[model samples]
Target: MAGELNGKIAAVTGGASGIGLASVESMLSAGAQVVIVDRDAIALKAICDRYGDAAIPLVIDLLDPVDCATLIPKILELCGQLDILHCNAGSYVGGDLIENDTSAIDRMMNLNVNVVMKNVHDVLPHMIERGSGDIIVTSSLAAHFPTPWEPVYASSKWAINCFVQTVRRQVFKHGIRVGSISPGPVITALLSDWPPEKLQEARDSGSLLETSEVAEVVMFMLTRPRGMTIRDVVMMPTNFDL
Candidate 1:
């Protein structure tokens, strides 16, 4: 029997590890062929090893708009048609906004918003033709709440959530569904910068949402029929985060 997502094609960014990697696994398990894009060599290869032909791994730096533009066409060529895009690649490279270096702020803006907009612009034409496709982005809770210690990161995420909301309004008329997943801290390689003591404390708080939990939100959006759309989903850890 064919899987629920049999014959579908998905492209995911920051897909080599963390929430991105988890989404890759989730999509594949649902029977969709996937193309994984990330800057990491080792993790990308591991993804390919397990899924083999069903998964294609590409090394990409999202901050580079050229990669975003180029990858858009490459995805269509590989899949013959594109059905879904999961723009889940992002990083936390900021301190407080006032003392933050200008370069770091620029990088965060480019990676978090500019690159994603470029990719969306490039892929939207084809998706428009079909008038049916899935677009899922991973935002953050900091998008809505305050992050005094990481103002730039907070601003970046808030902007991302705004982008998703605005795009949802623009695309829904065309039958293209757009949604974002806002996940509270979950264990992942992306959190490597946190000191061990701080990390343990967060985990012990008993409210961390696992990668699978976030994946379920993505699944819900995709599995929804044409009759409905999920604009944004904010997932909280039961213990600490609201």
Candidate 2:
């Protein structure tokens, strides 16, 4: 296992499944103290059993500001340091711009942008105080690719991309590196929610990017030398028409 991250403390939101799960494994293997935060209690319990005590699993609703506040002290208690915050939780509600439902739009904006902003707000002060930290956020290829059919998801990602980029400029001098990773179609159970008929078509048409592919880039960003920062990483499968 790679140990480049040894002795580092890495906090990962949405760490229970998908790319988050891959990151948890990679971070632990790289010898970082890993904290997996998610709202899935059963999955959280399973992760604790699977990764042992060093892989601390916390049940959290990212939409809650108090949850983020609670997270900081826990990290201090468990690892005595906070060197990385990997914000990788995201959700999608499909609809064309003209046909989108109001509630769906709200859910996408609230869960994606609002929660991320809150977590960043809560962590930035601590990172700035330490004068050394890395913030890795999950942006999306859709942010750049025009997808009016998925307007809310694409727009939310676009907002996050700008937010992280701005933070990179503001905080890099303060010893914090802020960056984003935008991956192609990541193969997760989340995609399986589509109808079985559409699922095969989606894969055949171009939607087979694996979660590990994106997780690898995330590791690349967080594990680089202290003085360097990977400003932005945007990638999609060649076959992906998007």
Candidate 3:
């Protein structure tokens, strides 16, 4: 499995930590030159330093429209050609929708939804020209289920789920494979939004997934034969309930 990604170049958003960081390590181990894209300048620098040139760091606020528009362009500028793109950066807003402010809701939608679309749109041209590329968006299990607690967050992911499938239909003929990974309750900072008791219960019950576990799924999706597109992978802990 090692060196499976040799000669490939990848760009992962939110690559400084959590699922993104773990995926970065997985891709690097498989022999891909990964560009760690995140807004955290310090963390990005640290990660790049650890991996040397194999890990290129790009620090920019994705929430900013100007920065978001320029993400793929910048990655292409740095890597020449982007063989893979992992849209893993996202924000969480759990609990009743009424309890959150409009600003929080807006921010979540912009990053979790808008920015993802923009990045995909921007990268499509390059991929189409080359006639080959892989795109993986990080969706959530909430997108498939109607969970009332986090309506807003779930809605954002649902939008992404739709987007991924629809885009796949349109782009497959171009030799571009598009898909999403819908993971349930991974142990990341995103869990901070869950109720304390619920989080503790999941941890105690072995129902929470690790970031690396999710990253391994990303690796699997990437390494599949080009003719076979894994449309969506929904992974969860064996003990996970609802």
Best by lDDT: 3
Which should have the higher TM-score, number 2 or number 3? 3
Give candidate 3 misplaced runs (Cα > 4 Å).
none
Worst 10 residues of 3 by lDDT: 233-242
The estimated TM-scores of all candidates read 0.94, 0.92, 0.98
Once all C-alphas are superposed, what RMSD does model 2 give against the true structure?
1.9
* Whole-model lDDT per candidate: 0.84, 0.83, 0.94
For candidate 3, lDDT tens digit of each residue in 38-63? Answer: 99999999999899999999987999
lDDT of 2 by residue, 1-242 (tens): 48889888898988999988998888998888888889998998898898887798778786666775687677777777888998888888666677777887887787788888877877888888999998898888877877766777889999998899887888888899998898867788657556788777767877667788888888888877888899889877777755
Residue 130 displacement (Å), model 2: 1.5
- Candidate 1 per-residue lDDT, tens place, 1-242, comes to 13868889999999987888888888899999999988888988987998889999877777766666688888877778889999988878655567777897788788888877777777888999998898998888888788777788888899888888898889888889988888877787757777898788888877667888888788888988887998888888877644
